[model samples]
Target: MTNEKVDVVIVGAGASGSVYASVLAKAGKKVVLLESGPDWQLTDLISSEIWGRRVKPAGAPILLEGKNPMAYAAQGGWGVGGAALHYYANFPRLLPTDFRMKSEHGRGHDWPIAYEDVAPFYDKVAREIGVSGDARAEEKWRPAGEAYPMPPMKTFRNGNIWLKAFEASGIPMVPAPVGMNSVEFKGRPACLYDGWCHVGCPIGALANPQVTYLGEARKAGAEVRAWSTVTRVLTNPAGTRVTGVEYYDDKHQKQTQEASVVLLAAWSAQNPRLLLNSATDKHPKGLGNASGLVGHFMMSHHVASTWAMFDEDVQNHMGTIAVQYMSYERYPKKSHDGAFGSSFVTAGFAVKTTDLANSRADLYGPELADYMKRAARNLAGIKTFGEEQPNVENRVELASEKDEFGMPLGRLIHSFDSDAVALWNANFEEGLNVARASGAKEAWSARGTMPTSHLLGGTIMGTSAANSVVNSYGQSHELPNLWVAGPGIFPTEGASNPTFTIFALSQRGAERMASQWGTLTN
Candidate 1:
């Protein structure tokens, strides 16, 4: 095996990994970022919804294909930028009460670090990534922080409809906090309100890794080696620290790289997979698997959508992927009963012409044509996202089956408990009610099946080694030099999009690594 040395080795050049690489490299540390996919550029992001499907691999849409398919509740993105390349840019922060979910609501475990502790980092990430929102509008849930770097995207037709419905229901609707550019912050141009973002933004208006951390990291002299899949992390004989990583390059040739520290930012599934695959004599089960919690406690938010046929056209498919509003002011509170509050957003409704045409396939001739004709108009829709409690049994484990690489594929055996199911049903009904209040001709609620975009808490963070894999600062309790920098470290899945939180945690981990750089031996 060939060996090369670096100060830090980061696996998975995704959202979290990109930020960590940028931060550490900017601090003048030598870093190598290994990604399983090819290097993609903003220009390469196709603008068609159907064509964007090519960006992610088949079978495993959101995650990289391994031994077993990596299943996400929504859908995931793969490749050099990881899932961030396909993110909707919804950048809401975790509500303050989200930190103490178990204490306040007797649900999931509380975070060792509170919203207050990470508030500054959140602000830093928002500014660095260029958030365009009105923090004042989110006063009830957002922590006290500096103003948004840019103004909010203009309200769209569907947003206006949803606003009225929320007003009628006594639920306030505020501009959704998005990472897309509103006024050209960070050298990116403002959004053109093209409504084609769900397909991936070709323009740099959306703050995907290509425009944010990846660019900065590359400019800072860090090397991102794409199509280099890390199979296992190697540690010293004592199993006290990481030595380097073994990977398969684009040519399928095995190679090794040494580093003083190794950071696993490969999302919830693969992070634990690498650790488990790296079993050695010193750590028989796996590296840092002393607690055997590496692949436990998988959490994903429950998402539900409500569609309405409004009397007036509410063209929703007209702005950023997610452009309208969010309601979390009274979330997770008593008003919602035992059901937790959900973060709801109303985007310019997608025109149902395509859906209608697809649905007409079973029907014949004139009836199909008539249905398609009527579906051409804008149909307003609102989606509600609710947090799921992290359950240890809902986990990612190595399947008995192996992939082409001879590595055990990640198999997700997740089941939502009764409480989570109840919360989902309640949120769906709430969304439908809002649609009705908006004076829609008809409203339909769609429950989530295998839909998930935000995956969190597999190798969760906690105060003790007995209960968690990582500590509050993201350092692995079982392996000190090994760190996790992603939503995987979250102890609880808060009712917000996790991109911002991932960046905050990455910044925190990077800072700690920088502070302790001297202690790390190369």
Candidate 2:
């Protein structure tokens, strides 16, 4: 059934959509954000790992088929706040080189805009939401920007173990730039450091959208329609512009939201899935697939995780469940002889049901129990992140299988190229060395490629429709009224987590969208 038309209908209430909802509403545009999951309020954020799974995608899972399948459900969000509700709040910025990957290295795709274009929004958003970091100490890794509003976040007991190794390896590390408060800012409390970040942070210190942008959106008169699953982006007869969207209500009834502007702001897979599923007689391939590249070039960071055991109690469970120390010595895309991409250091991972059991794949009976007993006090680990090249063959396509709503499920096909493999291998060996240098009585790592989450590509933003679905500002090239956002628009997957960049890009586009209200609606 048709609903009353509004100025804008944004799909997804996650990181990117929340930013748009917040800014556009403040700019006086009538905004409605549709989420496919329940309306998760702060009180709904339970502090239990098992209950925390509720925040993950509860509907149909993305069908994965590739050399290394992604951990989509583990990383994706289902409810109101989206994945931001359960993310660890690790807020590292994309290196300036990230934007110009192809321009500088003759590999990957160059962003239509540069890091400079995103810097202002990054600075503004970080301050507004409360980011804690030591930019000066991050050295050449961090680009020019205002210092973080808060200082570095809390450190765990295992931090010393990794710090010593970092020093010895000549890859000195500093406190990570994090979204959780180092001290109270914007009235949000400091992190409890209980390491319950895997579950949702109920105290409102972690900068999840519920505690930040969505709150702003509500105060600014934006309406968040939770349990509204957007299935297709409706286009005008000529497919020149998007008229609105078609979705399923919580009761599984069909509903339509007509808006002057329609945005596919969900994460990578869902955005392209919606678009490809919305094909019309005028645009047979997809609404934004005039170039036939709507869901191509899907990318995920190449990651490898390593763990170790210190002689005595290291108390690895006491701090933020995020990467505690940061180093970018290997951050240059071609820093090494054989490696073709950049890699970074992520150490002192929170030990929750961890030193992580992946290393002991063979042990289960008493061996696993004994390891856990020691891990309670003396376990620590390190993980290394490397950029994954955006290969055309790695992509998301509509699978033959359909969900309960009769929508074609998205099937992903992805594999690391030789360049990404070389990069991951070089850094993975060093990660093992770093663990050994920590004076660990025992050190080991999980075999195979680690399950990754910070996803990118699929509906990449570029210079034109011939090569990309959206432009520099995330405006769709084929349909100007149709916009896309989040990590899905990234041309390259830099090693750092994507939430920080997602906010910055959405903020940048939101301002432009607000400024062009007359041009768009008219």
Candidate 3:
């Protein structure tokens, strides 16, 4: 049977897809957004950590095989907001140097577009999303942009302690620009700073797509189909364009939804996996694999933390579960002594009693309880983040085994280079110094066990189709109507948090599609 057609079909209801849906719907285009997970509401957001586990994608587990295997589910969100539901809302712009990775640094791939191209969108998204920060504090490292709409969130005692420590070490610590409501901008309430951002925010204080763009799209008459897993992008006879998508509905029945244009915003790992799985006889490798780089260069940032046992009670759980202060002293390659690349440092991290107890393997029962009690009152820490240079060997290829949906699962293969290891080690020492300066009686550093949520560069964008999957507009090189959004399109993994960049890129992509599709005038 012939399927219902729309002006645009966006796969994934996360930040990028939701933003695209909102823009198109407001521009008077008919839009249908398909999500692999269920639709979530404000009330559905539970404050408990146990309940937060249910918010991640579990439809089918992604198979990981690498020296540093990514915790795919931990980094991905399942419901309407996608992974943004669990994100801490730390939004920072990529510097001008990030776009010219190869030309300037002779490492990583250069972006098809420049910082100037995406800067306006960054300002637009920051205002729309209600970021709270002192832009003047970030002026040294921040790209040219408008000041934040809201003042930076109040620094807690923990932040004050860390800031002094950072300052003593000659490290420049500035207020973190986070996409969180400091004083109720755009009808959203101010953040209470309950310190549960790693879970889900129930009050709409943080700018999850469910409360921001997706909410606007719903009001603008965009249709969102949750629990709808898109299986393939159906191509035209010439294999020159996408006609629609085939997906399994909530009821487990297969259905087709036709559209003039199709956008994939599923996520980094999944976006490339979907394209690779849609290989047809006409395009044996994959629809967009003519360049043979669809799933190559999959990269995630490396994070390591230094824990301190302080003499005073800093109350680490009192404020937002975000980086309150940051130092970009080593962000430029020329600024650091060791390593080919550089890293940034964040002030402090949120902690819980159970999480601390579980870390010490030697303690159990009463001993665990005693240690947790002492740790809760005296423990504090700072985390350092490093950039990952894209490597061809680091990728997501389809596994031989298929999931229940008749699609091949992705087998991720990733490894950090010597430069990356050196970068992490260099920053790790700096973090310990900062912790010790915070008046810690003892300080220890450890490598992060799991992968952070910053996933980038699977179907990366570049000037040449020979080196990339999409153009700067996020449109597939081979198929004009097929677009890919989200962090997966990043040509190089910048040192800053990626949510803001992703938002800006998606807005630019949607505007480009609108201009080309002639839907804005329609």
337-444 in candidate 1: lDDT tens per residue?
666544444444333244445423455688877755554554667777776677778777776667656778877766666666677777777788888888888877
Each model's C-alpha lDDT? Answer: 0.77, 0.85, 0.83
- Candidate 3 overall Cα lDDT vs. reference? 0.83
Best by TM-score: 2
Model 2 spans > 4 angstroms off: none
- What TM-score would you give candidate 1 relative to the actual structure? 0.93
**Where does candidate 3 stray beyond 4 Å?**
358-367, 448-453, 519-522
RMSD of 3: 1.9
Where's the lowest-lDDT run of ten residues in candidate 1?
A: 59-68
- Give the winner by lDDT: 1 or 3: 3
Model 3 agreement with the true structure over 270-374: per-residue lDDT tens digits:
888999989887778987889999999988888767777777887777778777888777788755566867577787556665446644545788998887877
Error of model 2, residue 196, in angstroms? 0.7
Indicate the worst ten consecutive residues by lDDT in candidate 2.
Answer: 350-359
lDDT (Cα, tens digit) per residue for candidate 2, span 365-415: 899988778777888878788889898988888999998899999988878
**Which model, 2 or 3, shows the larger TM-score?**
2
